[model samples]
Target chain A: MKRAFGVMNQHKVMNDQDVRRALARISHEILERNKGTDDLIMVGLYTRGVTIAQRLSENIQKFEGTIVPVESLDISLYRDDVQLRIAQPIKPTTLAADISGMKVVLVDDVLFTGRSIRASMDSLQDFGRAKEIQLAVLVDRGHRELPLRADYVGKNIPTSLEEQVRVRLIETDGTDDVVIVRSGDGNNSNG
Target chain B: MTLLLSGLGMVITLMVDVESNVIGSQNVNAAGTNRKHILDVDVLSEDEILNILDQTDAMSEVLRRDIKKVPALRGRVIVTLFYEASTRTRISFEEAGKILSADVINMSSSGSSVDKGESLLNTGLTLQAMGVDVIVVRHPYSGAPNLLAKHLPKVSIINAGDGLHAHPTQALLDAYTVRSKLGSLKGLKIVIVGDVLHSRVARSAIWAFTKLGAEIVLSGPNTLMPVGLNLVDGRANVLPPVSVQPDLDDAIRGADVVMALRLQNERQNGGYLPSLREYIRRWQITKDRLSSASKEVLVMHPGPMNEGIEISTEVAHGGRSLIEEQVTNGVALRMALLYQVSAGGYQIEEEHPNGQ
Candidate 1:
């Protein structure tokens, strides 16, 4: 209980160095599993995931000496949990790209219950199809209700279900960090 | 408005299948019956209307939450010339034109040269000379819109209900009305009752319904039915499908819809009918008539209805009536037509040879 309290506090929040180390490990794993980067395509579910996919593609290109195409998706309409809460999530507009006969790797910052990844599939159909699609996340906290498991997971942090994960990136927030807050964070709180 | 619409919408008209080689545009087949609006009963059918609706859905996305303006009809001029009077129909065109950024000139017979008996042909020619690309006309003379269209080589004529002729836009909206209510126009039995002879809405509805695969049985009094007139053919303005008995009971037997057209008692001036009582008893759309028909039948009319004369107020306001939807669709459809006709001319990256 004491160790969990230390991890949940602000002092142990992931910084830029932690994010770089995690992405470097993800880049090597993604290239290794797919055998090479030539047949791979990375598409991030917007908005933050879009930046993550681009950086992951760039990192993979640098480490493995091959290019991996990147795309971004917007999935506001295809969510099942939207009516359960009044959160009006304005999905970022997706970039135009035809994804036919290619493999797509959908990326996100955090995968908790894995529902967002399923909703992303519904949004992806408005565009064309690909041979296969895989999931890649930076943080995977396993309290999942849906049958979604990431192919490339950077960190597996098991915590109480009340804890909420917040991912902040410099491209969007002028800072890079992944922190957990309790039910009283006031932002991600149900209260 | 020079509207450069991307060819994205493709709504196929029902009976007018894609394989059918028949189309009745004014330029192509003179043997056509009503070439003015009936492009194809099947092929070049309402797929274009459906496409327009689809493109409209797409364009609405572009409009986002901002002021609804696209650089669609930027440099073009659309002239709204009406010899008669209208509030809903007239404003629909104006609003549609303004949204697409077209300069609109509203001309009425009350003030314009129409009072001096200026020919629709001469006025069309004058508008054509003024670089007007499209003409939306509502004249009291049946087929005057088409006659004006015949003279204007460069201008596309949109028939906003000609005098006792046919209202193509009204029919398009009616089709949209059915599409919205029932989700599709396939094999829907729409029995159009009242003023079949005189309602331009009826003529346009017949052509469009046949195109959309909605089987229709036009029913009304003998004096009101305008049959054997040489109207424009849709499939090359080919011959109109045949005129039969205008019996209301037989028409409504198994219909999926009953569209009641208004009775123009003012136009009749007590000459066409013996009495309003007789007209209502013979042609009025009642709940009983509807009840005897299909349970899921829809009731519709293009407004200014004769309460007990053509249809009971109960039926008009009661059930299955898409009367209000028709008016709303009129705005959307006319917006679509104006958007398609005028918005793309100035924005043309390549010259279209069809630019006569």
Candidate 2:
């Protein structure tokens, strides 16, 4: 029934077990690079990034026996395309603990245009200056408009601008997988 | 000439269809409106009112933060042009614009060119020539903001208060304060005490609260009550049923919220009331009069309160009073309005289909 809608072209790049393995590996990579969560804090972009940050925090607690605090940041108010597009709903950006003198790790589900990360960086400065800032992503699809690269990456999937990479987690989308969707008509009408 | 008129009509219809197609293709935010001015709450739909309230929740969060500022409206210029005297409304608008990082300029009739016999249109043209983004206007005549909105097609106009016509932001903040405390406005009995004829706040509230599914009861002297509130200002929109009770004690019975309107002393010279002492003896919102309502009934007053005349001093500062929070929510509500109107594009310059 689903194939009747021409959805057959979409396929999963990473399954549930593959996603678990990738996240566990990224958890170790974050710990190994930062040398054990001392002044480290995980700041998640809104929606999917928040769930990813919570999973990473839980994995770190399971392995290292210390729970790192996770903060959620909404960057809609800091977007550069305010006039070009429809207004996006502004969500609450809450930071309970100070980010000053701390190693901040920004986490997200996927990195594509890199504009959101630029807005996030601008939003983070208003709270306080961090000692160091690093980027971590579950999937790194390769068209970046800004000069930014993730310090820790789960998977590198190179594709054309017409293709879309969607990461679905059980906490948000009721599944844990990464899928790539390609337009059947080759016109990229939606973009 | 008839042929030419019909030809023009066809062209206008085709243009409207093409414009709608463009908007549909872009998937523009339908939650936002193309309204360039907020002169009154009578024209607002239910969805538009709810959207403003929802956005005010986000703005309130920013107000509670340590920074209390955002760059959402950075570089936008807002000018307050007041022909009437106001302290809270003017300051609230200025602070709201400043919090959104917009530069706010204040101009009053005493200092500006209005004292030198300059008309409102000329002043509006001067501001438009200087490229101001918005003009917050308060005038002593009704429909003053409507005049500015009709003339200044590029700039957004917000009516702070215009005679006895409307004070939309006050009504929005009142709805916000009530909804924040009591959960929902549906089926809530909101009894408005004291003057209803000369109150812009009460006028705006009647439209807003009724549209949100609340039952409104007006209580005051008969001379201070408007004749037909259901068709207020002879506006075409038929409002929900609103009852007017002359006896204050009967109005307070079993009410969920009681909002007291200020009795303007100027109304005395017009023979609207007998005297201040007589008005207070009958209409003042005293403690005994309040206990007739439910124990959980909330009290509100759109200030500069008359302590002994309209409401007692203890009740004004009492636990049930939401006066202070109303001032705070006023800033947030104005921020939401400023951001929405400026971002939601100006009104499309097209005549109505029916040609009213």
Candidate 3:
């Protein structure tokens, strides 16, 4: 509802080079803040979050020569907006390593209203208590509905209410880019 | 959770002194089985079957987790009110309920008040009074689950198996196992051998697989095959394109899956077949007969297998056999069914805009 709606035109904000640089800087910041990767675990949200986590883990491995474990979590059942969807199919949540008493970083592709992160926090309650939990995102689009913030952010983009922020990874979408597509008020999309 | 358990306590207290045979026969309209209760596979649409299979795949993931449990049906109470003795279906339902953190209570007709003349309707009302969320019932009569569902309006009823009528859950797990082994259920030729007439498993399997687009060939003796099941209300009863084949080799040729059902000893005494020896010679599923089928064909059997009668021991315990996997999938399938029925407003139906 912000402006003219164009479905065909997509404004690209980040390319492959920008994504790589952002991930490398985030890895350095994580190591510096945590004072080395001791008892560290990376958990990725399902779909795009998992791919971003693998990229971050690989970057950390290259920088510190330490292999970090990455797990994928599907928070479909924990989402507060489940009643609003057509169907809620709870996907697989594979955690190869237990996160008890460990420093865990939750990763996702795009962070908007932060409801998904909130759902992830609720889901984490059953997987044992983590000593510390942190949030990381590739794109932090402004307009968070929740009182939550990401500790590690790749890009901060200010967006209007009618705009949709989509993060596409090569593994899933066969592309590495972030775009903002404006839509009309006739169509309503969820974050 | 405590409140539900306390309510269960109230149900136990309400049943003080009673004992008699009370499985009264009521006039249940055949069409009454079309309610939300999965009494038989005939009531299910193809989309519903696919949806259940998808949900079963999701439930299977819980088995791989360290917790191995979920709170999807927490605070919900499910009673496995089984009239017949069944170790697999009962234990699997209990396990499924426990994994979903549902308060599960096992009630058998043997030691229960049903032996003391407590009717099915009264027993259902008693459980409904205690706020039971769902009841998984297996009775010796054909439409027993439908009867319980008709009497109890508040609780969901799942038919574990009701006489020769339907075992929808068993059919579901079998479909899941086949979908897991093969990529899809569409256009696959499945040969169901042995007793089809008395098998609730075969009836439900035929209804389920046909809905999922699988071509079914019912292979057995003329006396042992189901009659009057070809059509219902002028439409194909168990879905169309189902053919009846008496020759074992012709029926199994080019088949992707061969399901050998358990041969009932009662069939022999009823004059349906000559003897176990003649039945094995004519219809037993051996590896040699399976040579005409696909090399990667799967062999399945609903358990308590008559090793040498319906299926040879080697084929039942062969590499391509998914009998054990079917049993494992049973727990997960039941978990999905229980979660779908117990969790209010969850998927598996046309969602009401009012969210009832």
Candidate 4:
């Protein structure tokens, strides 16, 4: 749902330290699930998702002392809702290394509705058939319309349809935090 | 005094209402809105051109992948209706549509029902009945795509090339090639040589390059040059001023990009030139002539070149020539256009109850 701007209630759900810890925990979980980065590749959706993926890669490299390949995927072409919105300029999808026979982990900031993840998965298939495909998201605010679930989630904020979860990272937005903007009566708080 | 003041206020309010309606209609004509067709570059805003170029970059990335096919327009139908013969434009449009997974059907006037005197309107209605999403059209008459657009409100019309009027896609690819090489087109000198009288490519290039802030200079034989181009369609207000340089060498000197147009033999039955030899000697883009341009000057030609007659083989095959890259970019550029026009403006379903 499109949120109307101005005079809305903004609540910082996760601060800088909280974001860092959640990403660190998610990174450890990814490492445990994939078993030491062997034949592992990270593919991040464009914009903020790419930076979060890079941070996860750094955390993994520090823990395992091994570097994993990171790629960026732009799913604008694969979007199911191409007719719903105005067309924006497409960002380049870079997958330098071959992804065949590798465990591909798709990373993103917030996983809501799961439509973007669906589009990302569709885009990844055109590159090559992966050995396996997994998804990692920093926040999973329910309301998934697709039969999809994240393997590693940083936080679960359980948001209402009128609320929006925004992830601000240091690389893209010059900060690290997650906020929920609630529309209507500003005094109400369910947290 | 009070009565006169009230009358003035009413007039001002009415004027503001009229101005807003005009602005609203213009917004509808902008790309990605109610503008479902691309008939010419003259109607395209600067932002629309930039948006198309930026999208072409992403399409180029798709072309580099091993599996060049994307399901962007899957299950959609695109028809290429050509009233004239072409090699590259038709093939490139077909390739672009297929790359996006659109089922492309190619029809030519020679073999199709068009040969049986089927009117363009009838042909369009037939395709519409088949539920084709887009029509890439090329015709011998100018404004053919516009005519199709007027009648078929549901179908998107992309003008491949229409008479001596415009070839917007070709001009776009040309701009993409130059911009990729030269970083930016702003304040650069672009010299277009030869056959300006019957060249749709040149006409479109004049609008596109000038819109991108490149100064355009038209240089060709006197007989082939149109007099007072401003009078062509009364688009002088929108079209940037272009100078006609009769001396090809002078035009090439200090130029940033030199474009050579094919001397169209099929359209030149009126003795527009005294002889091919004389045309070659006076207007041919030889390596020596190119040497006078900027050292990093780029060369371009819209294909099926008359080689020795308009441009020398050495220059066409030279390191600076972007002829082949233009062909590659042509497919990518058309892919961007096909994707943009086909994707938007559908009656979107209401959001799922679960908010998908």
User: Using DockQ as the measure, which candidate wins?
Assistant: 4
lDDT tens digits, residue span A1-191, model 3: 33343345557789988888998998888888888899998999987888889998999999999988889998765666432343355567886536779898999888888888987887787788899999989888878899999999999988887787878778988988877777733111233
In candidate 2, what are the lDDT values of residues A17-120, reduced to their tens digit? 98898889989998999999999999998778888889999999999999989988877667766544445566667675358898989988888888888888
Worst 10 residues of 3 chain B by lDDT: B11-20
Query: Candidate 1: lDDT of A107?
Result: 91
**TM-score per candidate, chains pooled:** 0.56, 0.85, 0.76, 0.88
State candidate 3's TM-score: 0.76
* Candidate structures ordered by TM-score, highest first: 4, 2, 3, 1
Q: List the residue pairs that clash in candidate 2.
A: none
lDDT of each: 0.66, 0.79, 0.77, 0.80
Docking class of 1: incorrect
Model 3's lDDT to the true fold?
Answer: 0.77
lDDT, model 3, position B109: 90
Superposed by TM-score, candidate 1 places the C-alpha of residue B86 at a distance from the truth, in angstroms, of 1.9
- Which lDDT value does model 3 have at A79? 62
Interface RMSD for model 1 amounts to 18.3
Q: Pick the candidate with the highest lDDT.
A: 4
List runs of model 3 lying over 4 Å from the truth.
A1-27, A35-39, A58-69, A77-87, A97-102, A109-132, A138-150, A153-191, B1-36, B43-47, B147-151, B230-238, B344-356
Poorest 10 consecutive residues of model 2 chain A by lDDT? A182-191
Task: Give the Cα error of residue B75 in candidate 1, in Å.
Answer: 2.6
Query: Candidate 4, residues B1-356: lDDT per residue as tens digits?
Result: 23212222111110111122322232233343434667777667677788888889999999999888887888889999999889999999999999988999999989889889999999999999999989999998876776787677567889999877789999999999998898778999999999987788988898789879998888877666655443222223124577777678888889999999999875345677667777788789999998899999899999889888899999999998999999999999999999887776552322101111
lDDT (Cα, 0-100) at B101 in candidate 1: 63
